[model samples]
Target: MAQQLILVTGAARCGKSEWAESLAIASDRAVTYIATATVDPADPEWQARIDRHQQRRPATWQTMATVEDLAQQIEGAEPTQCLLIDSLGTWVANLLDRSDVEWEKIAQALLAVLPTSRGTIIMVAEETGWGVVPAYPSGRLFRDRLGMLTRQIGSISSTVYLVTGGHVLNLSQLGQKLDR
Candidate 1:
């Protein structure tokens, strides 16, 4: 199969992770789940969510958890494998403390390297632009950053799926018919 770079995005609890996982499994390759969420061993709720994810995947699939160096991880995957980066929002949250310039540098670096990944890549990201403007500064910052990053990744993705209520809509398949 040809190398596929897919971006699966939707609102929270919309099954983006499950969709990405299924896609990776269907690829018929050795799947490597690149988890971007930072795990806190003491938090039972966080541990429960992690446990759910762990129990859902096949035994043959491998998982790598990291808060940074995502591009390098994708680059390191074998050509015969499939790499699934579940949720870009948490990844951005992990780097929110950096100055605007620093964050730009990091985001640009990941964007630059993503297209060069050797294996099939499926990335899960949250679509938060439709919601109300965040009341706090950090919330607003996160919303804006995730929106910008999603657009950048979508531009490079071979396919972009907008998942809503467990249904996925292929944005590209809609066709670019402008109402001008």
Candidate 2:
């Protein structure tokens, strides 16, 4: 059987994560929430944000922190399980210090693993390119890399959802996929 791939993307605070969680709940399979953002105990705001997401998840769903690596975590999942990876932007930002060449390798590895994973995958990604071009070189790199990664993921995804203003649009149904 082919594994399901779902991509949910939106601006920050646009309920992207919540929407992805809903899809996971609807899957009727054992769900695992993979938090890509590393928990920083010292940062109160970040801690609170993580707490809110944790509180929102159903207790029946297991949660995994991607301290090892997101690709590895997904690759290890059971075929019958559902994996919700909330926010790819953070994952990109976390490794922003890497050179462009290194980032490409990382992104390629992730793309390679997504389709081969045993479980259903739902990814929440922030649409950062819709705003102004970033001033800093690093910021620009982050936006560009994330945009490219999201596009690649969307290409392989069976379903792509755009969440904004509490509305969810099924891009896979409503829009045309651009060939790279």
Candidate 3:
């Protein structure tokens, strides 16, 4: 099968993870789930989210918790593995909180992995630009950063899907929607 890089984008609670997982399964390749979520014991909600995700994923899929150094991890993984990076928003947030790396630097690092890595890539990113402006500086920064990352990845992705109400719409068909 031809190697494919897919980008799945949607708002929080919009089934981005589920859709990404489904695509990984359909790829018929050795799947590697790159989970960016960190388990925060202090926050019950986070713990619950982690548990739900764990329960939803198949036991046969290999899970890697690379909350940091995602680019390096992806680059180092076996070329034949089908890589699914769930939620670019969380990954960016983790990096921003951990280091002084600029957004472009991070994007470059992520973009570089697909060329040399021997695997199909399925990236998940939250679509946050449609909502009202965030009240806080960090929130605003996150929205902007995620927007940039989404566009960057989407440009290179062979397929891009936007999930809403558990249904997926091919983003490449947006402009052609009226023609159909």
Candidate 4:
């Protein structure tokens, strides 16, 4: 089968990660779990959350911690390895932190990464635009930019999934039933 890009999106605390993990495990190709989450030493809650995620993933899965240059990492991936990008929301947050970055630039970077990927790629991202607007301009900007990014990614993805309340619903016609 040709390389496929699947975009999985959902609200925070939803089972996006679990679903993505399931997809990766089911695929016969070698799996590469690209984690974008950086450890925050001062935040115990975040650290705990990361630990919980680590406990859930299989030990056999190769993990790569790529905080920056996500596009570079994705672009450099071997054609034989299936890649799981757990959460684009964190990547967007990191991009927002840089004053020189632009939304279109980020979107283009992501688009460039997917076409060259040889194996299946499943991306997980938070669905944050459905909720109340944030008071801060930057927060709102992030939400808006994320919405745009998701739409763009979904356009190129062969399959798109939206998880809510632990239920995963396929949004694309090429969808195969996912065993949750």
The models' CA-based lDDT, in order, is 0.88, 0.90, 0.81, 0.83
The number of the candidate with the highest TM-score is: 2
- Candidate 1 regions exceeding 4 Å error are 175-180
**Two-way TM-score contest, 1 vs 3, winner:** 1
lDDT of 2 by residue, 23-43 (tens): 998898999988889888889
lDDT of 4 by residue, 1-115 (tens): 3579999999998899999999888887788899999999999999999999899988888989877677887887776788999879898887786653565776688788887
Q: In model 1, how many backbone clashes occur?
A: 0
Name model 2 segments beyond 4 Å from true.
Answer: none
Candidates 2 and 3 compared by TM-score, better number: 2
Per-residue lDDT of 101-135 in model 1, one digit per residue for the tens? 99999898899878887899999999986968999
Top lDDT hit:
2
TM-score each candidate: 0.94, 0.95, 0.89, 0.90
Please rank every candidate by TM-score, starting with the best.
2, 1, 4, 3
lDDT for 106 in candidate 4 is 61
Model 4: clashing residue pairs?
none
Residue 141 of candidate 1: its Cα lDDT? Answer: 95
Per-residue lDDT for 38-108 in model 3, tens only? 88889998899889988998898999887657788778756567888987888888866534366567678
